[model samples]
Structure formats: C-alpha cells, structure tokens
Target: WTILRTRLGWSRQRPARRAVERDEDAIVAWRENEWPRIKK
Candidate 1:
C-alpha cells in the first residue's frame, strides 16, 4: 500500500507518468519511501 501510494503520488507529479509507472520507478520510490518502515 505504501508503494502504491508513493507511485500514485509520484505519478501525479510527473507528466510522463500519465503514460505508465515503470516497474523500476516504482521499485526505486518504494525503496526510498518505504524502506524505513520495513527496516523497523
């Protein structure tokens, strides 16, 4: 859910994201945004 929300928010901010949310981008954002929670 965290990853999904991050992707959604990131997507909204990017013009190209309207085309697609690439797997790599989502994974990167997921690591950057949600990794802290996972580590805890």
Candidate 2:
C-alpha cells in the first residue's frame, strides 16, 4: 500500500463493482439489451 501511494502516486478510491451473480451471461445481456437504451 505504501508503494502504491508513494512510488506510483496512487490513492485509495471507492471500488466499482456489480452483482456477483451477474458476471458473464447476465452482464452480456444487460450490455446488449439494456445498456444501449439507457445510453440514449
């Protein structure tokens, strides 16, 4: 952690995540079927 914060100049941040169950197929469906609509 010190190396990351000092040498690399990285700081802690809120991690992004999605549902553990929605990883592969369900996620693909959301991107194809729902995400585009939401983007518009």
Candidate 3:
C-alpha cells in the first residue's frame, strides 16, 4: 500500500480538472460565437 500511494502521489501532479474546465469554456465560447452568426 505504501508503494502504491507513493506512485499515485507522483503520477497525480498534473491539473486534470483545470484542463476539463478549459475545454468546457472553449466549447461555450464557440457556441456563443456561433449563435448570432446562425441567425443571419
């Protein structure tokens, strides 16, 4: 269990949640930009 914990600690340094949030923001921004254009 100690070895597993140590390995997990080292492997979990990246910001996964931030990456997902960024992707969601980008998709929202894209949809917002497209909505007005589609009406014309």
Local accuracy of candidate 3 as per-residue lDDT tens digits, 1-40: 6687697664435654555435776788878998789888
Give the alpha carbon lDDT tens digit for every residue of 1-40 in model 1. Answer: 6687787664334564445646887889999999988999
The backbone clash count of each candidate, in order, is 0, 0, 0
lDDT of 2 by residue, 1-40 (tens): 9998999999998859766666698778999999999999
- Indicate which candidate wins on lDDT: 2
Clash pairs for candidate 2: none
Q: Between 1 and 3, whose TM-score is larger?
A: 1
Question: Model 2, which residues run further than 4 Å from truth?
Answer: 1-22
Question: Which candidate gets the maximum TM-score versus the true structure?
Answer: 2
Score every model by TM-score.
Answer: 0.40, 0.45, 0.32
lDDT of each: 0.74, 0.87, 0.70
Better of 2 and 3 by lDDT: 2
In model 3, pairs of residues that clash are none
Q: Looking at candidate 3, what is the lDDT of residue 22?
A: 59
Q: Cα deviation of 40 in candidate 1 (Å)?
A: 1.1
